[model samples]
Target chain A: MSDANDGAATVHLTLDEVRALAKAGLAKTGLSPDHVDAVAETMVAGERDGCASHGIYRLLVAASSVKTGVVVPDAEPVLDEPSPALVRVDGKGGFAQLPFRLGAPLLVEKAQKYGIAALALNNVVHFAALWPEVEKLASEGVVTLAVTPSHAWVAPAGGTEPVFGTNPIAFGWPRPSGEPFVFDFATSAVARGEIELHRRAGKPVPDDWGYDPQGNPTTVAEDVLKGAMRTFGGHKGSALAAMVELLGGPLIGDMTSLQSIEADGGRGGSPIGGEFIIAVDPAGFVGAMLGEHMKHAEEMFDTITGQGARLPSQRRYEARRKSLTDGVDIPAALMRDIEKLLEEA
Target chain B: MSDANDGAATVHLTLDEVRALAKAGLAKTGLSPDHVDAVAETMVAGERDGCASHGIYRLLVAASSVKTGVVVPDAEPVLDEPSPALVRVDGKGGFAQLPFRLGAPLLVEKAQKYGIAALALNNVVHFAALWPEVEKLASEGVVTLAVTPSHAWVAPAGGTEPVFGTNPIAFGWPRPSGEPFVFDFATSAVARGEIELHRRAGKPVPDDWGYDPQGNPTTVAEDVLKGAMRTFGGHKGSALAAMVELLGGPLIGDMTSLQSIEADGGRGGSPIGGEFIIAVDPAGFVGAMLGEHMKHAEEMFDTITGQGARLPSQRRYEARRKSLTDGVDIPAALMRDIEKLLEEA
Candidate 1:
């Protein structure tokens, strides 16, 4: 397909079809069949949930990481219990998804036994969105919190230098029925991907989104891409980002964002850092009040939504519902790229 | 003292002098001697750290809450272990400080034993800042996180109704040699105290700080105080505030922000809600590497601050150091009010 024409066209595919295409593209990157399935399934979820930034758009980037030997396609995560309630997983310089998957059962088991459990995954490349992992635990009736660091793309509140990542944190709360209340957000004023999109479209971003190369606040998307992103809520967001770096990095015996960048000689692609996940069983503290507690949460949600305020995951849920019937709309150009990768395999 | 002239004067008091004065004022509120000392010490710390809003300035509010029977001065906190790794405390409708104090030793013990521990405090009126509680745990080489719900003062993003609390969350990370790193901030764009200060000064706040009664964004401090404060970071902060409401409220079988306000019959004072605390031992995960991990964190701090970035709590630490030598500076007007409270007691 001609690039110009392909860019203007969109391809609709069912969830299964997208998963199959993603799996094939991932397998072509020399990942083991099992590993490919795991990663591809997560990518499919990203597409299904309208997280286009984390979906098939990232397939080529994942392949490049594998080609560059940054990620070991066949490495198995090593799990150990540092304490009865702490599960440590060494990702063996591989994808974070597999280790998280390998550690989930133990995390759930320990949480049920001890009322809470923590899983610390180190030496992994965390390239996917965090909600999927926490959502998995929440689906099993466990409340979960997950945090991971990334390359430093954000400046401290008053500093010009990029010293922190657009550090993302995810929280999941189980409900009595239906989907859990889940929210995942980066601490930056705007996600880097959104800025990139704006730059591509020659658009100006909001004034608070980022700074220019000279460290002056700017609305120019191109300038923001060349400079640094601001933290979401100024100093407050910066502090939270710093907290995430500590909890997900050094606290887990992994590299802080600056350390990771320094070790990579300033070369950046996917984040090679640590993932910290904590799971808590509601019954442990509230006892029989768990049901009532969840009901209260549901009522608050209704009250807020009734006031015309949208919840964090509300848009994603709406997109998901639409996608379920209409299928995912993939750019034709990206589809062609994926097909090309499959043919090479 | 005349109101105008006293407001212009600054009274400097030594740490001991401040503690004595605060104790005298708290004792006048009909609290037990032990409770008076406990509450007074926290107030002294706030003054010592230069938190003007939370320090002796709030003494009258605290006293009024006691006098009105909103807080039971002699109520003893009851602590029980819900699980091996969970401690639950019922504050008996008293001060949050006592429950936190009563639960601290057990929380530390359980964290040391199981790698992590969670303390849920309910029915407590949280009158002070959260840092003191977490800082106490961090001093013992435990990383801690604490969150509490308050009366509704912040609005959900995209809505003007006051539905969430300022909902401050505090985090403390233990350092190997020096004092621990700690940060406490409300999820709102600006703290309510700050807005009140702006209103008193007849100054306009930032446009993003709050909304008018008509549900439109406003820079008028008076309008914001009469309406609702906006969450920091837009939707991201709202989500976090909601998370706090869940974890600190229903998850602990305590009143949510709205419920607390309603139960108060719309009479606002200090927050009567729940407090959730989690403590984790680094030795349980990285063992001897804890020192190295802390060193790495220090290096990041150095790099950031060396480039002009100020870490959260940096100013507080500076203030505390200055206070040690020069004493705390209190507004003369506030001192007069505190003296009146003491005399009335």
Candidate 2:
């Protein structure tokens, strides 16, 4: 893989090198080798899929959080698997991906036996993306819905000042074609990471994408960080974000207002990031009849998109296909930045 | 209670009277008395909350559907309860509200026992607003999520022709203030119901809310119906709606594309609808520690919105409160339309 730096410099680093570098950085923060490996894998997957904002870009931030003891590495999830159909975990301030990865197989296994299973994780951190997890489950023929709660960063309609994070929700369903329809997105006008990207690139953002400190639409990335982000669809996006906060922040015992208050008061960090996962078995509903319905649904989808309906995540996959088939193109400057992080370590 | 005629200009009718009229209309279409009453109750609730488009206004269309034999009232929901934690219901062509109402209770019951439950309802119709069901659960101290596949009337980012519906998703959680935080909204720039409202009122819509047949943004509601509805926040809203469609539509066995195709072939009526409901018990996490967290969550909510975070659905509740305290205020012209419907019946 070609490397790039934020300052427009180019360097060369294979994908493995980058992953190893990220893993090494986490180890420096007191994370165990296994846990560090898992985190690195999750972040690398994002980068591979062209989601730079969610991938290596977060390495420094996550490390800083760990260094500040904002997150715990050795924290074992508080498991509450009382039944075959139910599983719950308190992440206990560990890597967000750890609890999910640990719970995915268990939940999927339960679904196979009981037809459905749910695992709720409380007190994790920013899960990179839902598509990856959903994709994993979908590959195994399980339908999944993953929801994560967030903080106050996006404003509601007709008002300004952030009150919720761009809580993202994702879903995956399998088709007879052995392909999965995966959909994932943040419930905000735009994700904060996107803005951070623009800031790093020193580029102007779309006017309606964010707001200034006075709550006016702005093109400057810096202003949005100081103020609030706009919701995707005025009231609609705002409503969804609130839902995430309730689920990820409050309902699941993740970040509470008290936690934020404590964080703000310079007390030890405590934004218990929470996640909810649902897995389903087709046998519960249509059973063998599912194939028939899926075929019909496909025909219907084909008819509607006669010209072409862009299936969710198809674009990203296509991009990935192109990248792999041709070459994993990287911004020269970004590669340099990766090298810098490694050398600094 | 007062009765009115369609041609009798502005008039007032008690909520019960309106519901009765709707029930009578449904009865004329051969729906079972129980089913008609259930559907009528949903419409009345929408009207009481000032959601006029989803209220009595929809009765005409629904009755037409039943009269045309598009909706089968006697169809029973195919319940597939694989475990206490999950349920999958096939509406089998019944009224949309039937499965929604039934599913909510079942999911809530399961959640009450196991701390979490999920229900997926397939082959239904427009479920109206999701708040009532969520509020019902929330009032009982449970958190709920309700999502439904939508009609294909909205376009994804940078695309034209309605390939998606103004899919609405709702989330509800209880607050100690005797108020539940209930959020219901469409994933489009504006709700299809809102566009219908503007068209019925002979008013123009806002630019960017929808597009004309030529794929150009227009303020004309008629144009939106002919063209497409815009997704909120560009690609982000489109992505979210796509997720809803996959989970609530195809995965659940309702496909909008097929609905349009069947409609064209005169083999079906309005699109079949699908919905997913999830309920989670807070005690599943912190156990007895949940009470303290709830308090903290509410406080944090208050602190954020106390400064400026507008809680979702707050305005709707405020409007409903005002209407109840001051008496349901019916606009002069709308009152006439209701009277006309009664007379026509």
Candidate 3:
């Protein structure tokens, strides 16, 4: 079976079939069927939402982690409810998504009681793209802010050590259109995933995206292996990455990016990768305020974009709409691999 | 007195003297003494905080707005209690800073109760840097996010039109150190204020900080008149600016940038400016968790920067500490001018 980067290869599969295929791939690793479904569901949704790097493409990495016992299934999460508005969850070496799925609902519940809820997860795997969870809350009229400290793969602004991950932040607000508005991006010049993909393809990276050892810009992904990933916009992006590390890493007890690289195989343990999620119930704060604000915001967004501007989640919503109408767009290479795995299962 | 750009040079009065001078200047314009003092306090604090662009230096702009009836001093803010966590304040043609001050305390109060509070403001003259207000809340163990939209003076990623303002987003989070981590920055490459300052000083703008009319990079501020301000990181910056416009503009019933630019005098009587602020009480969610998380975060920050990485607010905090002990570093030229202004007053 070929991969998407293997050139002109794309296989079409229905959303259900894709989900099933992903589940089967996960199941092949001797995982419980339900958890497998959840992982596959998230991956497929990620692919459907145009986040290919975080989508089914990541299944191999997850499988590898499972085989290495880096991802422990059936591990119970340690949740400490410190306040009505905050919960701290220790992943206890389980699948990262499970704790997040469990914690998000609990956070929303707490937010409903108060006006906001903050949940921190330690000892969890990377939760992939942070927007999906945020979007789910936004749809329920909750404004959410999510941050995560990633595996060490990015360098600071002026350094040459991949001492920081592509630390990302996701912010979302509920809207009247039910589509909501969400913004999520890494603080890196380019996400580390792109670098990995480039390396896998034996391709050179864009000079602007990263730097080689000695802090010189290079187009070689393999060079990034020895050097560091540059921050976006120099100092500003570096500052943001630092803040994310503070908020998402040690603040939540996750290993620092620098420490992650020092770990064996670069997979974080102890405090699972730190993730912080906050949900605010607009109705709780201002009642119909969010609704009114949404109405006015729609007008403003409309006026700005005029003919062509779209909101953050807008493209994804459009993609989803199109998918529901004409089925999801599944890459051919992914489908073939999944089919093979399904048959093997 | 001649303006800074009028070749009159900057007058760096003692912080106390600067505030008094601004108050006196406002008082001469038929503003109530209290209103004069409030506005002066905010403006002066801006300069003290090293935000010279929005600081006491902008007194000229503030005076012009008031004289032109753009900033009404005696006007009262129309307050609406939409929910326990949200408050809407119609600036009612008042000084933007005035309403912000009034709303800040209210937000803190509500945040303490609801765990999260949002205050939206519309129909006011420009307010200075938002960090000060958010920082005040952070001192009380609250996290704050503030967004403001101003006149359109920036372009989208690929376009050449200044379709958005150098809109800024300010955020604050409290750490165990009792010093809050605050970030305030414009979505544009370099804020128009910074560019104007450079232009006034006949200094060239930094490459990658701005572009010329032909979409070419230039350091000449004069070129900005013909060209447009480019977004910071191409598409990412543009997306962020658009997000700020939506969440900070129409979301607060303020006019969108496009609409304001289309209106009379580009902004006069436009009532298009908008502000959005959210404050969340950590006690509401995490209880004792904040201490632990923040301590860990500080440790991480220290370790990462042990190699000399600077966090977002580290410089400001250091500067502030120095200023308090050894006195703030006032530019020699600026100091002389301020002395002259004092004698004249």
Specify the highest-DockQ model's number: 1
Show how many residue pairs clash in every candidate, following the order shown.
0, 19, 13
**Candidate 1 Cα outliers beyond 4 Å, as residue runs:** A1-6, A201-208, A212-223, B1-6, B201-207, B219-222
Provide all candidates' interface root-mean-square deviations.
Answer: 1.0, 3.2, 3.9
Q: Candidate 3, what DockQ?
A: 0.32
DockQ of each: 0.78, 0.41, 0.32
* Model 2 per-residue lDDT tens digits across residues B247-300: 565555556533543453543356666777777776665567788778767865
User: Between the candidate structures 1 and 3, which one is better when assessed by lDDT?
Assistant: 1
A best-first ranking of the candidates according to their DockQ comes to 1, 2, 3
Task: Provide a comma-separated list of chain B TM-scores, one per candidate.
Answer: 0.94, 0.85, 0.85
RMSD of each: 2.8, 4.2, 4.4
- Candidate 3 is scored at a TM of 0.84
Model 3: per-residue Cα lDDT at residue B266 = 46
Candidate 1's fnat? Answer: 0.79
Model 2 lDDT, residue A203, Cα: 90
Assign candidate 2 its CAPRI class.
acceptable
Consecutive 10-residue window with the lowest summed lDDT within model 1 chain A: A1-10
